[model samples]
Structure formats: C-alpha cells, structure tokens
Target: LILMLVMVGLLSLILGMGLPTTANYIVVSSLMAGVVVELGAQSGLIVPLIAVHLFVFYFGIMADVTPPVGLASFAAAAVSGGDAIKTGFVAFFYSLRTVALPFVFIFNTDLLLIDVTWVQGILVFITASIAILVFTAGTMGWFLTKSRVYESVALVLIAFMLFRPDFVMDRIQPPFQQVEPSAFTEALGNAAEGDEIRLVVSGPDFDTGDNKETTLVLSVGAGSGEERLANFGLLLLPEDGVVKMDEPSFGSAFSDSLSSFDFYGDDPVQIASVQAPSNQMAKEWVFIPALIFLAFIAFLQRARISRQGVPA
Candidate 1:
C-alpha cells in the first residue's frame, strides 16, 4: 500500500510539474484519484473518496517545488539571485520533510478532521502540530542543537507513533473480527447500540455491468436483527441456509446499490463478509509511551546542549 501510494505521489508530481494550481488539481483528480480509489478497494481498504483526492492534490502541489520545471522555484530564484534548478532541487528536498503527512492522513482520516467532534478536532490539531514539529526536527537533525544519529532516528519514530498511535494498537490487537455473511444477523445483534459494523457485498456495477465488491460501514442501532438490517436499507432472505439480498426499501440508504442486485439470478449479489468491531483499549493510550520516549530523547539532547554550553 505504501509503495503504491508513493508511486502515485511521484506520478502526480511529474504530471503536475509546470501546471498552474487549478489545472494541476484538475489533472491529478481526473487522472489519479480513481486509480487510488481502485487500488484502495483492491487492498480491502476503505479509503474515503475525499482522502484520495486530497492525497493527489497534496502531491500535485508539490510540483511547485520540484526540479527542472518548478515555476515557484524559478520565481524564488529571481528574488534571491540563486540558480532556478538548484533552488528547486533544494526546495524539493525540504518539502520531503512533510511528505509523510499525506500518507499518514490517508490511513487516518481523523487527521483531516472528518467526522470528529469539536473537542476531538482540537486535540487532533494540537497533536498534529507537535508531531509535525518533532518530525521536522528529526529530519533536519537538530532539536536543541545538532542531534546524534540515534537521536534523529528515535525522534522520527516518536513522531510516527504520535501521528499514528493506532498503528501500534492495531498490531497488538486486530481492530475487527470477520464474521461469515450467513451469520451477519447474529453479529449485528451481538454488537452494542450505535456501534459500526463493516459489511462487504459483491454485485454487478450499475454503470459498467461489471462485477465489483464494495465495503460499507453501517451503524447498528438498538433493534432486532431484521430491524437493524432494515434501518440500513438491506432486506435479506434465507434460501437453503444461505442468505440473499432482497429489494431494498424506497429512498433508503442502500437503495441505489441494493436496487441493482438480482436475488434470484445466477450471479445475484451476496454478502461477502461482516466485520464486527473488536473490544480494545483506546488508541490514545499509545501517546503515553510515545511522550515518555520523547522525554527521554529530550533529556539526552538537553545533556548534550549543557556539555557543549549551547543555547537551547
């Protein structure tokens, strides 16, 4: 996933070079966004459409700093009396310091402030600001003063942990338990009120008539199994011990997608897997250890600064 995204970013950068902002955005969005969306689905990743577009946009804008055709670099060179190509190369390397941000937010949409409460947004902003600063310090090889090689590496790791606390938590405990499609009702009933259940369904596409699978995260409200499914515009019928989709109710959330499904046809739509959210500790708990590690690095840097009589 990371390598594919990196390639997409590089492609966006190359395609966007020398283009104006609006044109660059249009080109990347039209050409690259769908590629990302397709890649994400193939990887079983539920990437938000907005995230994919923003990812392309971020890299597209980086073209301004890239070498050879960087218009912004040419402008900067005119003002600073530097070589245009050299300035662009330097700027491009500097821009790479924050390059990980787009990738970070792609996997962690909360960083984009999507679907977050005001308090959560504020916390995200604060932590994101600190993480960026630490990341910059790490990459630039200076915090209080020049850093040791190990300190720089540790700083980068700490910054990553701060940016993606859940990465560690996910490794420790998988986020979801996959349930069989036939047993989706049982899983839905077992979930707590208002919790999310990820449903995977495969069916023919409405536009292209090609077979495609999509993932939907439905909120399971307090109700019986049938009622909960009805709330999401899904009606299931059991035939020979296998559950099949029925025509969705009018104007319901799943109407558009479910409407195309032919329950009785040879290639009828079917539920693939139902993922129930697992019980795990809050991801924020990881911040504690990350901060502790940051403090340790800070202490070491401070000691170096004291020994060298360097001003912090």
Candidate 2:
C-alpha cells in the first residue's frame, strides 16, 4: 500500500506533466485518487477525500513547471531569453514553496475544510494564509524589508509553528487520556441524555481477518440499559452470560461506527482499549508569538524601505 501511494503520486505527477489543466485534473483524479483512497484505508492511512483529490491535482499542476518538457518554463524562456531547462528548474524551485501544503492537509484534514466549524474555518484560513506568506518571505529572503539569513530562518520556523502549532504540543502532551474499559459501564450509566460517548475499539477485520482499530462515538439517551444503547442504534442481547450484537439499526450512528470494525455473527468484540477526549492547548496560542515575529520583521523591512525612499 505504501508502494501504491508512491506510485499513485508519481503517476499523477507524470500524467500531469504535459496534460492541460482540466484534463490533467480529470485524468489523474479519476485514475489515481481512487487507488489512494482504497489502498490507503487498507494500509491504515485513512486520508480524507478532499486531501487525496487535491494532492493529485497539485502534483499534476506542478508538472507544468517541471524539467525537460515544462511548457510554462519554455514560455518564460521564450520571453526572457533564458535557457528553458534553467527556467524550469527555477519555476520548480518556486513551486516547492507550496508543496508542503498537500502533505499538511493529508495529515491535518482541518486545512481541507473538513468537519470544521464556521469560526474554525475562518481562523484556519486566516492563519494558514498568513503562515504561507511568512514562509514565502523566509524562502525568498525578503519581506516588507530585505531579511538577513538568520532572520529568514527564524521567520520560517515561526511560520511552521503558526501552520501547525498542535504538532509540538502533541509531542509534549498527548491529546488523548486513556479511559479504562472496566469504567465504561459507570461512564455510560452516568452519562446524561444526548451526550456523546466516544469509544476506541480494535478487533480483527471481519472481511480480511486483519486487526484494525476504529473509534465509536455513540450518543446517550434519556434512559438506561438496552433502551439507552438502542437510542444510539445498537441492539445487544445477552445469552448465557455473554453479550451479543443482536441488530444494528440501519443508517444509525451505531451501525456507521461499527461498520469500520470487524464483527462476526452473534459474537461480542472485545474492547481492547478506550479513550475519553482530552482538550489540547489551542493552536492559536502559538499564532500570537508568530504574528509578533512577523510584525517585527515587517517593521524592520518598512524602515529599510523608507531609508531607501521606496514608495509606501
């Protein structure tokens, strides 16, 4: 599957090289995107649909600036009297500035605008765009003012922090605090009506027999027992001191969550583990320092530009 991902990405890149924009998108996405989606899940990657499509599309578009047969570079060379190969290399270098974005969205679906609240969407857009600009400034060695080498490096690091502040905090403090399965009964019993119960479970895949892990976010009801579980679309019947999955309501959250894991007829899946969501430090927390650094650079650059009598 890892091989498949690499192959898909490379193939998409190659196919994108000479193809026109719309056709390039249609061809690569139609051919390779599905392979990534299917093989990725089987490989335990579970990348978002939006991310995969964008990933292929990005590489396809990148082909235009790539070496050897780069049409964009040829056009630029024709206009600027430069070698086409050199122009292609230069264009490719510029394109590298935005390459990290696809990988970012692949790991963090928030950047793809998936499952984000309206407020979060706005914040993400603002912070991400600003971070990209900062990164560009660092790479180009210019901002509002010309940047020293060390200052450019610092700006780049600051940009990365603003782009994915949670990355560092996660290493320092893991986001999830494990919950014991033994305490599940108490937790479920005590949960108020309409509350969400998040459970992470791992079991053998019913189809492939491979062990796979998935999270089940079940909703609690106003009542308790089988009735409570039923509210979340689960029907469990006990037979001879053993709990069994009786019937999962079609189109219900229970069935939807359960579909990700393997379940056999009338057999209870052992709960290998559990986790209650823990709030992590907000990514925006790092944005403050990043913005301050950006402002400092801007101030220095503005002063330099003024000294040169450049137009404001």
Candidate 3:
C-alpha cells in the first residue's frame, strides 16, 4: 500500500512536468486518480475522493518546479544565469517542506473540508494555514528570526501537532480496541449504547472483477447489535459459525452506498478484522496546548530578534 501510494504520487509528479497548468491537472487527475482509488480499495483504505484527487494534483504541480525536466527551474535558471539542474534541486528541497500536507490530509479527511461546517472549516483553515507557516519556518530555519537548531525541531513538532493533533492523542490513548473475530458476537451483544464497531471485510468485487477489501463502521446503538445494523440498512444472519448477509434493506443507506461494491456477496464474506471504539481524550485537548507552545516559540524568537536589533 505504501509503495503503491508513493508510485501514484511520483507518477502524477512526472506527468505534470512540462505540461501547461490546465492540461497538467486534466491529464494527471484523469489517469492517476483511478489508480489511487483502486489501490486504496485493494488496501482497505477509505481515502476521500477529493483527497486522492488533490494528492495527485498537488504533487503534479510540484513537479513543474522539481528536478530533471522542471520547467520552472529552467525558467528561473535562465533569469539567474545559474545551472538549471542545481536550481531544480534547490526548488525540490523547498517543495518537500510542504509536500507533507497532502499525506496528512489523506489520512485525516477533516483537513480536506469534507463534511465540515462553516465554523469548522474556518477553524481548520486558520489552524492549517498557521501550521504550514510554522512548518516552512522550521524547514527554512527562519521565522521571526533565524531559529536555533532545537527551536527549529520544536517548531516542526508543533506544526505536525497543529495539523494532526489526533496523532499525539492517539499515541497517548488508542482509538480502537481489537476484538477477536471469534468473539465478535459476544462483543457486539455487550456493546455500549451509541458505540461504533468497525468491521474490515474482504471479498470479490463482481463489478470490477477483482478481490477488494473495505471497511464498514457500524453503530451499536441502544439495542441489539443486529438491530442497530439494521437501522443502517444491513441485515445479517450468524449461525453455525458462519455469518451471511440476509439482504440489505431496500433503498437504505447501506444498499445505496455500497450498491456498486457488492461487498455483501452471495457467499459469506471474510472477516479480516474487528475493532471497537475506545473513548479517549478529544484531539482538541491537545490542539490548544500545541498552539500555545507554538505561540511561545514565536514570542521567544521575536524577543531574541528584537534584542539583536534585527530588521523586521
């Protein structure tokens, strides 16, 4: 999965080189977006559509300034009377500082503005912009003033936290508890109200004529596991050590959403893994503290620069 995603990004970057902006996006998105979707499906990764598109598109744009066939690098080199290859490498180094954004947003779709409210969008925008600015400052070793080695490292960490606060929170508190497939019934039966149960399933996708893996997040509400699943438009029958889908409710969310995938095949699907949600401290709890630390670093830098009488 890791290799395939990297290849997708590299392919998009190469395709974008030497192409006009409009044609670059059109060609890369048309050719490479489907590769990401297919690879993501095979890997059981629920990457958002917009995230995949942007991931390829962003790297493609970056390629225009990257090495070998970098048009931007050549143009800049022409104006500077410098080596095009050398300028391309330098441009590539700077672009690497921002390339992490696409990867972070790929894992955390919240950054893509998917399903975000106006207020949430504003907050994400503000935090993400600040995080990227701090990230650039650290990568370039300059902010309010030239950053010390340790300060630059801290700034990078702070930027990552601001961009994905859940990373730290998840490390401190696990997000899910793995449940044995054999004990799935007992776990489901005893699940708490409003809890979410994640099931990883794999089976043949007839539509694509390929084996595919997908994840289903089922809500275990104030009743039996089956009942809550039914609410989400799924019907299951588990007996004699086998689980089968009886049938999805007509016109239901499950049926509508997965109509094309056909995860609920005629044969019993393979249960790859099961995970139950764990109540953990919200990521916001970490975000606020990280933001404060970042502000403190900026303050220290500004004060140091002021003492040194550096020009603003």
Candidate 4:
C-alpha cells in the first residue's frame, strides 16, 4: 500500500507540473483512484485518497517556483527586480495553507462526510472554520490583535476539539432491548398455520426435549400404513404411549395416510430468530477535529514566524 501510494504521488507530481491545482487533482484522481479501489479500500475514503494526489500536485506546482525552472518566481523577479530565490520562498510560504488543507480533510471524516450526524457535523464545521480563521490570523499576525504563542496554542486546541469526531456524543443509542426468546415464540405462534401443532422444546439437542424446540405435527388418517410410509415417514408411540419411536415406521395406519396428508416438514421448527440493528441511529461515526488541527498548524506557523519578526 505504501509503495503504491508513493508511486501515485510521484505520478501526480510529474503530471501536475504546469496544471492548476483543481485540474491536477481531477487528472490524477481519474487515473489512479481505480487502482486503489481494486485494492479493497472503501470508495468513501476518496477524500484521503485524493488528498495524497493533491499533495503531489501542490509540490509539482511548487517546483515551478522552487529553483531552476522557477517560472513564476522568475516572472515576479523580472517585474519587481527582486531576487528569484527570495521571491519563490515568499510565494511558497504564503501559499502553505493550500498544501495543508487537503491533509486536514483527509484525516478527519467529519470534514469528508464520513458517518457524521447533522448536529455534530454542524458543530464540527463551525469549530473548524473558526480554527482556520484563528490559524490564518496567527500566521499573518493580522487578526483582531496579534496572536500570542499561548493564544495560538489555545486556538489550536479549540480547533482540534471542533474537528475531532466526538465518539461519545456521536454514538448511536440502541432504541430497544435485546430480543427475548418469549417474544420470538409469540411471533412464531402468530405466524403458524391452522393444522400446525407447536411444541416448545429447549436446548441444542432436537431429539431430547431438554433444549427448546418447536415442532409442527401433522396427522394423516386415510391411507394404509405401508402406502403412507411410501409417501411420508411416520413417528410412532408405543402401545403404552410412554415411549415414542426414534425413526419413522412404515406399518402404521398413520403411515398409510401420510401420502394423503400434507406435512409441514422440518422447516418451521428450525426457524432461527434474526436480530437487526436499529434504524434510528447511524452505522458509522466521523470525527471533525482534523480541520481544527490544520488551522492550528497554520496558526502556529504564522506565530513562529511572527516571533522571529518575520512577515508571515
């Protein structure tokens, strides 16, 4: 996976050389995302998948401003008569946020729309946006007031809370108690047919009534035992009625009528109860804290530069 991602990043960077960020993302995503899907990861993780591509795309664009082929830097230097390297560095620093934003959304599902609840999602959006603002302000040293190191840190922490998914709060509350056997029995009885005889048995053993089992008994009265036995097997009880035969008997009158009488078979008695998740809650949870982290980093960078008396 790591090797594949590296190759994808390299390809995206190579292809992104002169393309706009959005165009570069589209091109690489179209070309490489299929390969990832084939590898068995969910398609929903596309945000992160595309983020890697975009990271390479950003670097590819930066290559133009980095050194030898610094076209944008050269153009600016020629116009302003400034040093090309310095101009390139300035541009790179100013656009740092662009490179970081993708990572933020990629790591945080709330930002990327993974298993997010409406109220929680909204809260995440609001907090992350504020964190971004704080980060930008700290970086530029141009918010309502110049941000102190501690203030920047606080802002970052707040952003982290906003972007991180609140698992405790986001958890889906189960709407009902576990299904009881009695309930299952009631449901089965309600669904039983008129001719069916319901026997409640216990345990995993079907032969011994120790285990719970529901049996449907059918009786055939009109045919010879041999004829009935030919059509359907019979269960016989001893003359004393204390013991029942383990296997079907062919000589009984009941066996004779077995052909004329319809048997429900072993299907209903073996019905297994099903348990389903509640429809009221979500199956997944997404954390929004990532956006805050991005904002925090951006703000930290800005603050660090400011402390050095440098323009962010």
Candidate 5:
C-alpha cells in the first residue's frame, strides 16, 4: 500500500509538471487513483488518497521553479535578463510554502476531512493556515522583528502542532485553547460526550457449532437510553448458533443467520464502522521518519545560521 501510494505520487508529480492545479488533480485522479482502486485499496479514502497524489502533483509543479527546466523562472529571467539559475532558486524559495502544503494535507486528515468534528475542523484550518504563515516567515527570515533562532524554533514547533493533531499535543499544549472561550469549551464538551459509542451484542444465529461463540455489534448512539442514530453492525463472530445478550440496553436487538463467507474467510461480514485508529496510526507511522528528517534539516539550518551570526 505504501509503495503503491508513493508510486502514485511520483507519477502524478512527473506527469503534472507545468500543469495547472485543476488539470493536475483531474489527470492524476483519473489515472493514478483508478490504478490503485483496481489493485484493491478502498476508494472511500479517496480524499487522502488524492492528497497523496497531490503531494507529488505540487512538487512536479515546483520543478518549473527549479533549475534546468525551470519554466516559470526562465520566463521571469527572459523578461528581466537575470541569472536563470539564480532566478529559479529565488522563485523556488519564494514558492516553497505552496510546495509543502499538499504533504501536510496528505498526512493530516483533519485538513482532508477524515473523522473531523466541527471544532476540530475549525482548529485544523486555523492552525494549518498559521503554520503556513510561520513557514513563510521561517523561509523568508521575516516575522515579528525578523525571527531569531529561538523564534524560528518556536515557529517550527507551532507548525508541527498545527500540521499534526495528536492526542498528546491536545492534552499538554493546545493551540486552540487561546482561540476563544467557546471554541475549546465546546470541543471539550463534545469530547465528554465521546464521539464513539459502544453497542452491546445480542441474540444468536444457527451457524455456530456449540453456541459458546458470542457475537456483539458495536455502534454509535446518542446516549444511554436514546436510540442509535447509526448502525455499525457486529463486532465479533460466533462459532455456534446460541449466544446470550449482555447489554441489550445499548441499541436495537436483532437475530439472524450469519452472512455467507466471501472476503475474509469462510464467513463474510460487512463492516460499516469508521476507519480504526490502529490502521490510521499505522498509516501515519510513514510520516514519522519524514518529520524527523525535516526536523533535522531545521536543526542543521539553525546551526549554520548560528555559525554565520545571521538572524535565523
């Protein structure tokens, strides 16, 4: 999956060089994601999927601002007669923020709308925007009083928080806390409600062998006594046909024969739940090494600046 995604991104970037944004998305999504789907990855996660596609898309466009075939820089140089390589470098640096944005959205689903709440959605937009601003400052070495080393470090830290919304950051140093009285308060209030609701298993099917196998379906609900707004069926499977209901008070009760086996094993089941955290975390693990690498670059840049006595 990882290799496939990377290939999609690389293909998109290479194909999208000098293409407009809309054309890039259309071409890549039409070509790249189709190939991925044919290979069996779910299409529902297409947003992040396309985000990955766009990561390479933007980088491909950025090649126009880089050397050798730097079309945009070449055009600008033709008008000004400045050094083409220097012009390309300047253009690339000036446009670096645009190049970095698609990667952020690809890694952070809040930006791409995966399991995002209203408040969380808002925080993501605000923080991401601010992160872009900070990135601009860091790249240009201009912010409140021409950002110094510590200030650059602070900007990078803030950008990290903004780029990735993790539970650890929420608990310790929430940037959204200072937004407004209602923002954080409402988010906490919703958090108290807990977005995920657990549904208890009930009834039995004749497919089990000894009836010792128990089946339970976990679902989201309004509250303890309220009817479930959505149905996310069975969490487990029973080897036997008999099972007792433990928590009938949770959601609607149903008893039916197990569906035919198809996708997984001899018995097939349809899953309607949101993407699991384990899966998400695993996917996100790909970005950790990349993040560490970027952080190292920042650290090296800071050290170099310090040595030169330049305001970082």
Candidate 6:
C-alpha cells in the first residue's frame, strides 16, 4: 500500500507540474484518486475515497515546489533575489517532512480528526504536535542542540511511533479477525451502524470465464441484514449449503465492479471471508516506549551540547 501511495504521489507530482493550484487539483484528483482507491482495495486496505483524493491533492500541490519547472520557486526567487533552481531545490528539501503527512494521515485518520471523541481529539492534537516537532528536528538535524547521526535517526523513528502507535500495536495484535463467510448474516446483524465489514468475493469472471477474487468493505447502516447489503449493492442468499450472490441493484456501490463476477455459473460467486474488527487494548500504550526513546535522545543531545559548551 505504501509503495502504491508513493508511486501515485510521484505521478501526481509529475502530472501537476507547472499547473495552477485549481488546475493541479482537478488533474490529479481526476487522474490519480481512483487509482489509490482501486489499488488500496485490491491490496485489502480499503481507503476512504475522500482520503485518496486528498492524498493525491496534497502531492499535486507539492509540484509547485519541485525543481526544473517550479513556478512557486521562481516567484520566491524573484522576491528574494536568489537563484530559482537553487531555491526550488531547497524548497523541495524542506518539503520532505510535509510529504510524510499524507502518508501518516492515510493510515491514521485520527490526525484528520475523523470520528474522534473530544478527549481523543485533544490526545491527537498533542501527539501530532509532538510528532511533527520531533520529525522536523530529525529532518533538520537539530533537537535541543545539534543532533548526531544516530540521534537524528532515533528521533525520526520515535516520531513515527508517536504518529502511528497502531503500527506497533498491530504487530502485537491484529486489528481484524477473519470470520467464516457463513457467519456473514450474524456479523452483519451484530455490526453497529457506520461500522465497516470486510468481505472477500470470488467467482468466475463473466467476460473471461477466469476465476478472480477481491475484497470489499461495505458500510453497515441502520437496517436489517438484507437492507444493509442492499446499500452496497450486494444480495446474498443461502442455497444448497452455500451462500450465493444475487445480481446487484442499480446505482449501488457494487453494481459496476461486481457485474464482472458470474453469479450463477458453475462456480458461483461466494463470500470467501468476512473480516470483523477485533477488540484490543488502546494503541496509546506504544506511546510510552516512544516517549522514552525520545527522552533518551534528548538526554544524549543535552550531554553532547554541555560537553561542547554550546548554548541550547
């Protein structure tokens, strides 16, 4: 997923080069947003459509600071009486930290404050502030004082952990547990409104008659199981001890892509897995180790500064 995001970001940067802000957003959102959404789903990571669009838009705007054809850099250079290309290079260098924000928010939507509680919002604000500061210090090679090579690396790692505690938590405990497809009805019934249920569908392709499988994340709404499924354009029924997929309704989420699946062929379309979110301990525990490591770096930097008699 990260590799795909990086590739899309670079592509957006290129496609948006030398374009005005409005034109840049239009081009990148039109060309790159769908790629992220489709690729993310194929990779079993269902990114929100808005998030994908914002991700591309972020990188698209960054083109102005990139080299060779940096309009923003030229304007800045004209105002500062500096060389345009050099200014572009320096701007791009500084932008590396900013580049990390889109990736961070992609996985940790709390940074965007989506679906967060008041307390959670405060915590997110605090951690995000600290993370950004530590990240900036790491990238700039300074923290309290001059940072050693190792200290800078540690600071960056600490910042990442702070920004995304779930990355560490996931290693300890997976976020979602795979449930049998037979339990889809039960899972859907138990799911709270607005929850997402990941479903894997597989069957023979309608056009090529080849077998294919893909994951779909359907949003649960306030309704019965069948009604909820209808929201995503899915209709599943139990027949002959196997769940069979019926034709999707018009103008629903599954109407377009699910059409390729041969629902009534020899090998019928069926749900392969139903992934339900697992209950786990708060991810904030990872913050302890990250803060400890950050303190260690600060202590090391402080000692170095003292020994060198540098004002900090």
lDDT of 6 by residue, 31-85 (tens): 9998887667667776676778789988888889899888999999999999999
Regions of candidate 3 where Cα sits further than 4 Å from its true position: 1-4, 41-44, 76-83, 179-197, 203-213, 218-268, 299-312
Shift in Å, residue 102, candidate 3: 1.2
Candidate 2 lDDT at 124 equals: 91
Query: What is the C-alpha lDDT profile of model 3 across 183-254, one tens digit per residue?
Result: 665678788876778777665665864656667666676667556666777655666755545446788765
Per TM-score, the best of the predicted structures is 6
In model 6, where do residues sit more than 4 Å from their true spots? 192-194, 204-212, 221-233, 237-242, 251-253, 256-267
Candidates' lDDT values, in order?
A: 0.85, 0.73, 0.79, 0.47, 0.49, 0.86
* Residue ranges of candidate 2 with Cα displaced over 4 Å: 1-8, 31-47, 74-82, 115-119, 144-146, 169-173, 182-201, 205-210, 214-270, 296-312
Residue pair clashes in candidate 2: 145-301
Give the C-alpha miss distance for residue 224 in model 3, angstroms.
6.9
Order of all candidates by lDDT, from best down to worst? 6, 1, 3, 2, 5, 4
Clashes of each: 0, 1, 0, 20, 7, 0
- Each model's TM-score, in the order given? 0.86, 0.69, 0.76, 0.41, 0.48, 0.88
- Candidate 4, which ten residues in sequence have the lowest lDDT sum? 194-203
**Model 5 lDDT tens row, 73-183:** 889999998998899888877776555576565556577767777876686676667677767766656554455676576666656655764533434443222222112
- Local accuracy of candidate 2 as per-residue lDDT tens digits, 1-312: 545755776788799988889999999999888777756654445577789999889888889989887888899999999999999999998898887776666666788789889999999999888889888988888877678898899889888887777776777666656666665555666666655566655556677777765556656667764466666675544455434443368987657546745566333555545444456676667778778877887787788778888653
Q: Select the stronger candidate by TM-score from 1 and 6.
A: 6
CA lDDT of 282 in candidate 2? 66
TM-score of model 4 (CA atoms): 0.41
